[model samples]
Target: MEFRAKTVAESRVETVHIIRPTDLNDAGRLFGGVLMQWIDEVAALVAKRHSQMNVTTASVDNLRFLQGAFQRDVIVIIGRVTHVGNTSMEVKVETYVEHTNGKRDLINRAFLTEIGLGDDNRPAILPRLILETEEDRKEWERAEMRRNLRAKQRKEGFHFYGE
Candidate 1:
């Protein structure tokens, strides 16, 4: 049986600010950690919608800082679940800077895999994923690759910074 799949944009919960003061480095740039925090929050929301259970970050893959966000600029975090696994969902989040003139630029892109936890504090199964569009197909393929990579790394006994 096939279950319905939800898009990343559909599960976005909120848009937080990329305040100038958050740039602790004083390099006149928004900090990388700040952007990650925003992405985590948004990805959590997407995971909750898909799993209907408490979720926690399993791993963050391919978080590339493509551009920088200015102090007063607004970073819009858009996120959605691209694939649902037996006990985890992969969420793709894109952050963009909105200029005063209404121009938008893609600042960063990342993928997060979060596992749904049951009341027993163990991973739980989620609804099956359904791919609807070409973009979704591409994302699903990418997600599969990421999953395989993570598994291989785990078997090799490597410790990552964040999981």
Candidate 2:
């Protein structure tokens, strides 16, 4: 089947949440695990939007926690497709703390690789990504570099998880 190409804007996702006590860690800030889960969801939403297919996360790269968020803080998350491969797409997710003044402070950033899944639960072809702006183009180029680095690492027998 010929998949339709989708623009980065088409798959962009934004979500907001209030940090709760249950979502906090020992230091009284948002838990890292919870934040990671939220990031994963955002990335998955972007990939699914771009692919129009069920998707699963294949890998996560360059996850950087820049700051901590506390309880009662309004958190904002934005995810967008940076690039697409034959079967997978790269999604960049950014988490921010929104202030009452409508300003946002970035707290975390992560990139995820998600693969489209066919009805049979195997990898499926994904639609190509249309970069609309210079920023999008730069993101695509950066994604390409990350992809190539991952490939080289894999080729050199580097696996964080046991094969």
Candidate 3:
């Protein structure tokens, strides 16, 4: 199969949702898991757009919740493919919240690695990620470093303490 290079903008995705009471925690702030679900969904969309094939989440890195989003706030999620490998791609997702008073704050950021899958349920080749802007280039470099670290960990048989 011929793989064509695609720009980050070509596969970028954005989603918006309002934080409802059911989405809030006991403290009245948005639940982290809920936000994570949104992030993963958006990132998956971005990966699918870039790969044009069925994909699954391989891992999520550096999911940091910088701030909290209160109920009734508008949450905006932006996701874009940062780097692509033979059968995998890394997508960076950022979440922001806009308060009723019109104040905007960054809530969370995460990098998700997704592996494209073929009909045989094996890894499938993905389209190349084209870095068009300086920011895109920087993100690509960072994704490469993260990928290398993950490989090293796997090679050393690293596992979480509880696992």
Candidate 4:
């Protein structure tokens, strides 16, 4: 069967937030959990914009903390939908540290996969992912492979129920 790719919908607002003491670790660095929370929050907003409904974090792939963010540093999170499938959306997210007060550099990068669910709470297909750039194409291929691999694993009884 022939099908078309579902390109990403325009996101309403690229949300931004600052790190507070509550979001920092005992060592005075931005906690990894804090970054994950922000990532999830932004990703959810993007997914909802595309899906027009509530969504949840289905999985996260290859999350790397390349550098550390201090308490006063601004952790900028950039998110976009890289791919979409029946009820699933793959969001590419990157974290950058804007610390003119400290030193400006990219602190981290990560890929997060979120699945859109219907009221019944099952995997729902949303849109087809359309790729343009060679980099976007590469990531789309990777997401496709991961999606297929995960589907195969699930069918083969490798349950990732909690994870």
Candidate RMSDs in order: 3.0, 1.1, 2.3, 4.0
* Candidate with maximal TM-score: 2
Estimate, for each residue in 121-140, the C-alpha lDDT of model 4 and write its tens digit.
Answer: 77666756666568778877
**Which sections of candidate 2 miss by over 4 Å?**
160-163
TM-score, cand. 2: 0.96
CA lDDT, candidate 2, residue 46: 93
TM-scores, all models, native as reference: 0.85, 0.96, 0.91, 0.78
Write model 1 residue lDDT over 14-113, tens digit each, in one string: 5757567846456878888878988999999888887777899988888999977776788788887887778888898988888889788998999998
The lDDT ranking, best first, is: 2, 3, 1, 4
| TM-score of decoy 1 | 0.85
Which tens-of-lDDT digit does each residue in 129-149 have in candidate 2? 888899999999999999999
Per-model lDDT: 0.80, 0.93, 0.89, 0.74
Estimate the lDDT of model 2: 0.93
Worst 10 residues of 4 by lDDT: 1-10
Backbone clashes in candidate 2 total: 0
- Model 3, 1-163: lDDT tens per residue? 6668899999999999998999999999999889989999999999989988889998899999998898888999999998999998999999999776867688899999899988888999888878888998998899889988987887899853433
- State residue 112's C-alpha deviation in candidate 3, in Å: 0.4
What is candidate 3's local distance difference test score? 0.89
Between candidates 2 and 4, the one scoring higher on lDDT is 2
What's the lDDT of the predicted structure labeled candidate 1? Answer: 0.80
Which candidate leads the pack in lDDT? 2
